[model samples]
Target: MIADLFPHAQPGAGLIGGVMIGLAAAIMLLGLGRIAGVSGLAARATGIAGSGAPHGIAIAFILGLPLGACIVASVTDWKPATYSAPLMLVAAGLIVGFGTRLGSGCTSGHGVCGLSRLSWRSVVATGLFMASGFATVAVMRIAGAL
Candidate 1:
């Protein structure tokens, strides 16, 4: 489906990205005893979370997200993906922030870390996340909005 949409199926890039993510998560766990959850890190970075990783670390991690992308794009033929209008982007971000709070963590936390650790809660949460994503896409497609 992605190839259908973009025609550029970069499996090597996916592998590289997956390996990098796993390394980052592993480093956070083994070196810092923290789960590499972007949502929690974001909250911590913004002082919304009262307690968690150090503020500096959170800020660095959050900043590294886009910075890393920029670095890669500089070296490789990587083009930043664009979504919708600014208003829609902001609204989607707010909704995702709320959903991350409601769901207890983002995909990185529950889907990768929690699932790897055999957490039943994460399993359920990830399942619901996938289902909701599918449903949303289905609805959007039906409405000719996808």
Candidate 2:
């Protein structure tokens, strides 16, 4: 099973991955009384919220994402493969924001916590999320955009 996941699996990578995820979720829930739904947090930061945590903390978490990636790269041999230009990245962010509003939650909510709770809506939302991602990748590849 582990071999199926990574042909060149590094020792303790799976354990480290699971620990990181658990720590993130636990910290979010414990400190904020909210799920670490990245999309919801992003929306709130961009003025789409009624009330929430101090904007600074949310912004910090958002900013820390890239910082954390850089830190990992510093410690390991990892680097970002490729990404869109600034304008395209902005457009993608807007589209993602809109989609999260339409979908009522992000992957962390629907695909992680809600699904764990056996929520039917979550099940459907997760399915749609996966399908849409697959479709997007396929369409982009077909158009030579990937």
Candidate 3:
């Protein structure tokens, strides 16, 4: 119905998702007094690192990601994207993990939560990551790999 009502409204889904993320971040901040950084939470959950929040909370938060995705998949007519190769997927995951560690946060941490609070570190990190992403895409396109 929505797709039919607005044939070109592709941004609607993204906008809604962004708003939901912001709300979740805000709740984490205001209610729990913690930054909703997924990388940090995951690290804490796995005993790789510790944040100010308890490990149990972090574990629950980490678990909620897939649970939420599953719920959304059940209710919505959405499908996950497929990659060309399993090796490529593993490589991408490794790169992303390295990047999150290097940057000290992921996109959700810096782009959504950090930027909202006007953190200079996050601003610089987000800008650098965004530029790096664009450059990566450009290079991939030139190499006919994307």
Number of the predicted model whose lDDT against the real structure is largest: 1
lDDT value, residue 61 of candidate 1: 90
Which lDDT tens digits does candidate 1 get at residues 15-73?
98998998989998998899999999999999998988899999999999999878888
lDDT of 3: 0.88
Clashing pairs counted in every model? 0, 0, 0
> Across residues 1-146, which tens digit of lDDT does each residue of candidate 2 receive?
87888779865877897678667877877877777777777766777775665687778777877888788889997767887899989988888878887887888878776776688999999998899899998999999988
lDDT of 2: 0.80
List the candidates' TM-scores in order.
Answer: 0.89, 0.73, 0.89
User: Whole-model lDDT for model 1 versus the true structure?
Assistant: 0.91
User: Could you tell me which 10 consecutive residues in candidate 2 have the lowest summed lDDT?
Assistant: 45-54
The best-first sequence of candidates by lDDT reads 1, 3, 2
Candidate 1 residue pairs in clash (backbone atoms < 3 Å): none
- Quote the lDDT for 78 in model 1: 71
Candidate 2 segments exceeding 4 Å error = 1-15, 54-57, 85-90
